[model samples]
Target: MLAQTIVNGLLLGGVYGIATIGFSVVWGVMGIINLAHGAYIMVGAYIAFALNQWFGLDPFLAMPFAMVALFVIGYALQAFLLNPVMHTSLLLTLVVTFGIDLFLIDLFVLFFSSDVRAVHTAYSGSSLEIGPVLISWVRLVAAILSVLVAIASYLFLNRTRTGQAILATALDREAARLMGIYPDRAYGLTAGLAAAVAGAAGCLASTIFPISPTLGISFLGAVFVVTVLGGIGSVAGVIIAGFAYALVQAFAATYLGANYQQIVAFSMFLLILIVRPQGLFGKPFYGES
Candidate 1:
């Protein structure tokens, strides 16, 4: 049972890690905490469901369409609204993002209702047994996709010129500008990439879990907690933290009451904050001492 729980957590964590990577990329590159990030995920899920229902496309194949569509939406939002607020105070940005979240939630609820929906494909119920581990094929697929996306993102950030520009912007906005990187365009691109990642995760998550407009709130917390525990600027740290959080939650649910699972899981977040305030991998914020 313990081993099974661990596997469940690992699978869940893999999906959460994808969401965290998106969150971290935006934060690390664009300095935006983007409270509306989960809404984008929700939108992507809906898009996949819609395509599968209407056009008979497989959720996996429909994911790229959802990703591209969300990317455009994210790009436009950043280009217009967020770009104008680039020089504004952080508090103001936070307020704006929260407002965006509220709007999206209401919009989705109005359009789709609050009913839970899932993309129930034929393979959704199948599982593979590898020795002691009983792995759901859907979970395995999601994990594989998550790792692929994360590794692709890592390579893009490390190898590509535009990717390096985004990294430089994250490192130092003023320095990036001095080095000929256009800050506004870079931020828009960062936002788009974040949305794309979110979309892909959403596609996978919808297959594993039911979706509702309010689902984003729960996912928002999970992804942010994972991101905070992992560290803001470290991709590898996010991956490790994802698995750690998953294991922690799975253990709590298995040994303790399910009701206390959240309490135990977030306690780790608090513990990490107290012990390593700079995050597990990233350096401390400027002017800490």
Candidate 2:
């Protein structure tokens, strides 16, 4: 039971980690807290759901299309609506994203209603028994995809030119501009990539959990805890922190009750904030005189 619980937590954490990476990336590159990130995830889930319903496509197979759709939406939103106000106050950006979130929720509600939905595949109900642990095939695939996406993201940032530009912009926007890197372009790309990842996460999540228009709020809360726990800008930190957060939740749910899971997770979030605001892997911004 203990080992199985640990494995379950780890698997869930991987999916959670993937979902939060895009949120972290947008913040890391653009200094925007992106309150609408959950909307992107919701949109992706709907897209996959629609494809499966209409075209008989498998959710996993429909994920790319969902990702692409979200990428376009994200890119357009950043390029047209956000870039103009990029230099504005942080509060303005927050309000903008919050408004966007509300709009997305309403739009989805209008179209899909508030009914809970899930993706049903042939392998969805199947499980693998490896000695003492039994793992669901759907969850195993989601976990593997989550880890792969995170690794790919890390490699892209470290190895690619556009990614380097994004990192450079995050480090110092003025310096990045002096080097002929357009901050607007980088920001757009960052937003698009973030949305794409979020969409993929949503598609994977639909396989494991029921989704609805309002489910984004729950995901938003999870993203906040994971992001803060992992350190804002570190992919590796997010991944590790995600697993840790999942383990905590899993143990709490198993021992205490499912109702206490959120309470424990939030309590840990508060503890982290009080003890180490910079997070486990985040760099300290405050300098000693």
State in Å the error of residue 243, model 1: 1.3
What lDDT score goes with residue 32 in model 1?
A: 76
List of clashing residue pairs for candidate 1: none
- Poorest lDDT segment (10 consecutive residues) of candidate 2: 280-289
Q: For candidate 2, write residues 1-289 as lDDT tens digits.
A: 8999899899899989988989987876777889999999889888888998998899888778988998999999999988887776655888889999999999999999998988799888899999999999999999998898889888888899989998888888899999999999999998999999899988988888898997778898889888888888778888888888889888998889999998997898898889987678876531100
- Per-candidate local distance difference test: 0.83, 0.86
lDDT per residue (tens digit) for residues 102-212 in model 1? 998899999899888888888989899978889999999888888888888788778999988988887788989999999999989888988988888888888888989
Weakest lDDT window of 10 consecutive positions for candidate 1: 280-289
- The count of backbone overlaps in candidate 1 is 0
Q: Tell me the TM-score of model 1.
A: 0.95
